[model samples]
Target chain A: MTDAVKISNRNFSVFYGAIQALRGITLDVLAHQILGIIGPAGSGKTALLRSMNRLNDLNPNCRVEGQILLDGEDIYQPEFDAVRLRKRVGMVFALPVPLPLSLFDNIVYGPRLSGIRARARLNELVERSLQAAFLWDEVKDRLQTSALRLSGGQQQRLCLARVLAMEPEVILLDEPCSGLDPISTSRIEEALMALKSKYTIVLVTNNTKQAARVADTTAFLLQGELVEVGPTDRIFTAPKDQRTNDYVSGRFG
Target chain B: MRIPPRNTQALAVTLLAGATGLTLAVLVFVIVFILGKGLPVISLGFLFDNPQEMGKAGGIFPTLVGTLILPLVAILIALPAGVGTAVYLSEYTGDNLATRIIRFGTDCLAGIPSIIFGLFGFIFFVTTLKMGWCILSGALTLAIMVLPTIIRTAEEAIRAVPAGYREVSCSLGATRWETVLKVVLPNALPGIVTGIMLSIGRCIGETAAVIFTAGASLRLPHSVFDSTRTMAVHFYILAREGISNENAYGTAAVLILSVLLVNSLSYWMMNRFIARRTK
Candidate 1:
């Protein structure tokens, strides 16, 4: 994993309308390291991922406070273009949602948005991205087909390829393999393992085993607060906090 | 429990008998009578060609064109605006007083009478705007009349798109506008199309609103600025004026057939588009 300062959220609090979703969350995602944020429902795991790119800003009642820095630059600073930030900090969702376009279009949507043209260039990018996501052989022949027609597992990989094609330095994945079968889950884990070499990976997942299998570091969150964060081995085998121990031991979420 | 098996059977029979005798009979009778008295005089030429062969009282060609052209124009104006408004309400616009007020206004407009819409259309489109008694005036009136339905239905459809989809889009670093355009709109296309079809159907059938704004003329409209007649208006004029009873029947049949054709085509097109998308 490459070492560089990437995304760091400092004392960030988020509210949905009058309800507080995240409370004073502070975290640092190192460059090229897979950071796993694990928590039960409503622990603000997903909210943290969204806040990185200011996706929560779409909600009129949603309000955020404190600093979120990307490469030591304040992302919330007005001069920083949110649109451009999103293009550089791409994401994959829990359920596969390839935009209702052809598979080829789905893979190249981000690059095209960033003004990448030339059929040869796009074709190369598509092939590389699909290969990176381990989805090329299954979908290469039918890239022209609608992305919606693919099986759920294939759709998820297609979404991964889509994000990869943008060539973003940071990749945010929110429970990327939650809905897949065992083989599909293993494929995604393999892809994420390969991806961490080049991209800074921040993953939010409920699967403790999956987190241990792929993450360099693991954070345990409960009730919208980060309880503990450390190396995956330390967090799982020897958690410093009691809550993290209970969580990792399956005693309580 | 078995004290009155015969009585229970008798009660069921009586209840179903009353429903079949009263409710079903009225519905069947209404449809049969309307179609029975309205079908014989309808012909191909009466439907497709402009109503120019027999003065203002014979053919309904101009009216047919007017009915199709104006509503289609109105739909062209309303589809994007209505769907955009719905997207704003469902996806972008927050729960604010302005959004609430717009929703309330739309609801009120939906309940307003078409005659009142005609009066408003006359004063606004015809006099205040001085658009004259043209098809543009008529189409503007119809668009305003149908806007509420389109907004309400489209809003519901947009709202029905699963939150998971929106979350997925946002998480993918799609800006709010991109998410709404690339994800929400495509997912909600079927429902939005249904709303448009409903509005089109209403616009085609409406006469009271078009009557005051769209002057009763038998000539084909070369532009939206030209006054024109519609099939519904022709049906009314033929039925009321002492022209010929057959003309009225033929006009009504033509109106129904045109509406059917529009509805069928919309259904086919939208279904095909959705099927292709899913494929």
Candidate 2:
């Protein structure tokens, strides 16, 4: 990867009312690289990913201290428009949440909201996004069908295509494959590997093997604190932290 | 293993079945009695002709027209207001003191006696506002009376929408209002329609409120401001005064049939909407 820093957090901490979710931690996400975050439940993995796009802001009592910068700009500044920031950074959730709409409409929903009204352009965007998410061949003939009718895996891929239609700079996936079978999981992993070339991807997963397979760099978080972060191969083979070593080797989460 | 006593369980089952059978029997009895008495008087001339000789000799066509108009006007006014209030309460506000008070106010509104609503309508819409015994006054009264039902049901429906849908919409950079209009409202439509249907039933069956606000007039209403008599009000007057018991039964039968028709239509529409959504 290039030397450019796509996103970086400096001493960032997240609190929900009186309860803190993330401790003061620093990390850098390099441009055009997949950064995998792996941790067990209550480890703040989802919290960290949500904070990147400010999705955590939806919670009324959620508080963020310190800085989270995207392209060297503080995202939590008073004047910063969260709507615009979210447009630049998109998100996918654990379960597939296709809107109650057709597959074509789902892909065009974001674009339509952004004022893209040309039918030809929307059709092209749908095709390109589906192709990128590797869902075109499966769903091309039934583009006008309801998205809810798709299988669990296809629905998840449709969600990826929906986000991709916006042409976001960074994509945040919060356990995107947690609800899928192994074959579906592998399909998504392959999509992630292909996606890293164009967008900076931040993947939070409970499955460590998934991180090892697709992540260029993997960060291990435990109990709201970063245990270690390094090149994926090194982190898996010989982690510097004992906790990371034990966790990666299936000793403990 | 010792077998449990079956006597009490069997008695309980028998009691439940008897209760259900009793309810059904009562419903059938009422329908059969009304249809038997009213069907003889229901003729083409009786249905279409205006009442004459103080509503004792002719049909209830004017009252039927008034009945239809009152509910239509009431629903047109109440639906948007009630649904808007529900959306505000469920989507925009938090569980704060103000929200609690708003909810309490809605519940209170729902429990107020229909007679009290009638008095309020007479004072406010008929006398104070000088609407003066018209369909509009009656409709406005009914609208306020049914607002609570609409608000409660619509709020429940809007709240029932999955939070995941909102999160996904927001992540796609849709604004709060956009998310509500595009995703939330469409999903909650069946519930909203159900509420409206219930309000329609209430408006149609209401007698005391319409009597006070909409004066009993045998003539058909040409405008909203003209005095009118709904079927319920007409039936009550005819039966109470011993003017025409046959016409009263006939009117009651028509009212029941119309209510049933409205209910079935609403349910059919709601089922279609839900089916399309799931598809």
Candidate 3:
């Protein structure tokens, strides 16, 4: 992985109403690498991931303190347009949502909304994005078919492909494989490994083993606090925190 | 007294089926009775030719034209405002005091009687605004009457769109307007169209409100400012004025058929929308 920091969260915190979900987090995400966040329920993994893209802005009660920077520039600056920022940072939700449209239209939705109206360019984007998500061969025969008809696994990959079509600089995934079966999970992991060479990825997962299998650097969070973070191999085999050790060894979650 | 579970199940099914059957039977009976009394008077001449002598002879053509024009005008005026209000209420505003007040106001408007609306229209549009007993005055009244329906339905439709869809759209860098236009509007189209269709039906069948605002003139309306009589108003006059019972039935028959046509189209569209969404 490159030493260059793609994102930095300095003394970052998140609160919803009276509850604090993330507290004073300071972390660096290296460029062109997968940073996996593993935690049990109520550990604030999703909140931290959403904070990267400012999707938390959608919640009325959500409040943020401190600063988060992308490429050494503070994202929370007054002039930063959330819409434009989203173009640079795409997100995939846990459950697959295919927009109830034709597979072709679903993939092209982002580009079309962004004003890429040329039919040929849109077609090229659909093909390229689907191939990158490893969904091209399966769905190439029926591009115009309704995306809702696809199987669960296919729909999830289509969602991934839809994000890919945006050509975003960073990809934030929140428990993307939590609902998938073993085979589908493996496919997603493979796609993520292949994609990390091009896009900075932050993944939040409940399955710690999945993180160990794929993440270059893994952070273990507990009750909205970052207990430990290190290279995935060391974090798994020889973690610095007892909680991380206990969690990784499957003694307690 | 405890009843056997199987017997209770059977009794509940019978009661529910009987309720449904009774409602359908009443509807069929009313439709059949009207058709039986009126179909003989309905000929092409009766439909196409202008009435002679206060609708006692000739045909009901001008009233038919009025019925068509009034609703068309009302829909053209009301659809954009209604849907716009609904989008603003559901998407832009959260559940708060302003939205609650707006919703309560809408519900109150919906519950007001048609004749009360007629008095309000006569006072506001006809006299106060000086629109002068014309199609425009009448259409404005109908537009106000149906605004609640259209707003309520459109809001429900927009709200029914999966929240996840909005999240996805925003994540892809779409502006709020872009998300609403491309994602929310398309998904909500069938419901919005259904609401408009139902509103048109209400407009077509409106008699009390139109009579007060749009004077029952037999002359064919050349413009929005011209006074005209709708099918429902014509039916009321012909029946009440004792002009010609035959002509009155004919007008009632035509009005019923047109209302049925619009309603069924809306129902069909709604069913298709539901099916597609579920699929």
Candidate 4:
């Protein structure tokens, strides 16, 4: 089998009630790589991330016209199940969002919904997923406690674990560590590194140093258009685009 | 911040004291008058015995039971259905025409006059269906009457839950149903329960609707099909019929006391549920 679990979008434009948000933008996501999308506020970074799982579909006024393919399968086909697609392409939000459930339920929730029900198996999956998210030790003794009771950092990790339990092929992180402390940020970076072996990681962040620290590939988005994308080292060290360099150097948004 | 001048502070304090004292005096006078007037006729026999010879009244047992039964039935039907509709509106339904219409309908339902509901119940459940004066008709009427309360309260509660919770569940690849069941409902439960309590209060106190639809049967209702008389209805009948002035006063007092007790109990239950969830 080919190594690529590729995602390609051709001339994709998005509109919200006649107000165009994303201009006709084309992009490709390579497999098994961390793709970092960097953008300022309202530059469409969040919108682009939301589009991958078709979460934008939840908004009645949102309209998207384009061809988006996942490994040669058209994701925008009328028959495509958004729910199933979301399961395959999981997302983590900027805020720490633990469900109003016990931590155990938080981790096992997706797996159970996907039809895994054996008690022993669920417990094991919960443990494994939490460990993968680097939160097992801090939360092991309090697995049955409400997930909301966890500290902010722990809640974010728990959210990551919850997503990991679904075993998605692609994981989307929308500023996952934006709300965390330095230690938690490092832990999240470590978890992302560990996760890259199993899932194609796509991240959106405002932190340039974080992108330099974890991303294998970096793409800068300015005013809803892709400004530049390349290997992270080249993008950070010697970029071909002045806008990309200016953004990294903090010249302007 | 610098303190106000002594005269200004004193004037403010006096004003506050005067207002509070006046309000307290009025409240106390009303309570004392009602109790003083009504207490004389309250007897064990009056509470425990069934109405004798068409409400010559040694008892209010049937009315008390009927009051409890109708409101309980209304709550039993309204709690889940109302909360479910609220969950759909708050968590599932996007801002669309249908959601807007449903919300508008609920709002309009909430404001409709209770007497109109009674007339409606009388026509639909009683005359059209030939159900007659029965607990079923009364309970159904009360259910519709209180539904708007339940839905509005439940909707507010569901809305109060932090959006982060839903987003987290969605991120976990959980379906919308799963998110609502596991995350949203549990968090909003206390609010929903509060709504039910409020609905129960309105249902129990409702005299006009139950009287028209349920009829004034002094017997204990064995089923929904049986006619019943709630405490409020009994109070109204006693006051209107004037079997004796003493009986009317006693029945009114009993009805008031029961309503107070039920409201307090509902408040206590709400606090307990909130504490349990937070703990």
Best by DockQ: 2
| Residue pair clashes in candidate 3 | none
* Cα lDDT tens digits for candidate 2, B55-169: 8998989988998999999999999999999888887887899999999999999999888999999999999998899999999999999999999999999999999999999
Clashes of 4: 1
**Candidate with better TM-score, 1 vs 3:** 3
Off by over 4 Å in 2: B1-9, B275-278
Query: How would you encode candidate 1's per-residue C-alpha lDDT over A1-253 as one tens digit per residue?
Result: 3667688899998899788889998988889899999988899998899888777776677888889999999998878888778878888888887777789988877777667899999999999999999999998899889998899999999999989998988899999999999999999999999989899999999999999999998988898899999899999999989889998999977
The TM-score of candidate 4 is: 0.90
- Sort the predicted structures by TM-score, highest score first: 3, 2, 4, 1
lDDT of 4 at A97: 75
Candidate 4: tens digits of C-alpha lDDT, residues B12-127: 99999999999999988877776787888888888888888777757888988898888898788877788888987887778789999999999999999999999999999999
lDDT by residue (A145-227, candidate 3, tens digit) is: 89999988888899999999999999999999989999989999999999999999999999998999999999999998889
Could you give candidate 4's per-residue lDDT for residues A1-253 as a string of tens digits?
3247477777887888988788877888888889888978888888888888888876778999887787778888999887888889999999877766678877887898889999999999999999999999998998878777889999889888988888898899999999899999999999999988888989999898899999988988888888888889999989888989898988986
TM-score of each: 0.89, 0.96, 0.97, 0.90
Ranking by DockQ: 2, 3, 4, 1
Ranking by lDDT: 2, 3, 1, 4
Q: Whose DockQ is higher: candidate 3's or candidate 4's?
A: 3
Q: Candidate 3's C-alpha lDDT?
A: 0.92
lDDT of 3 at B36: 87
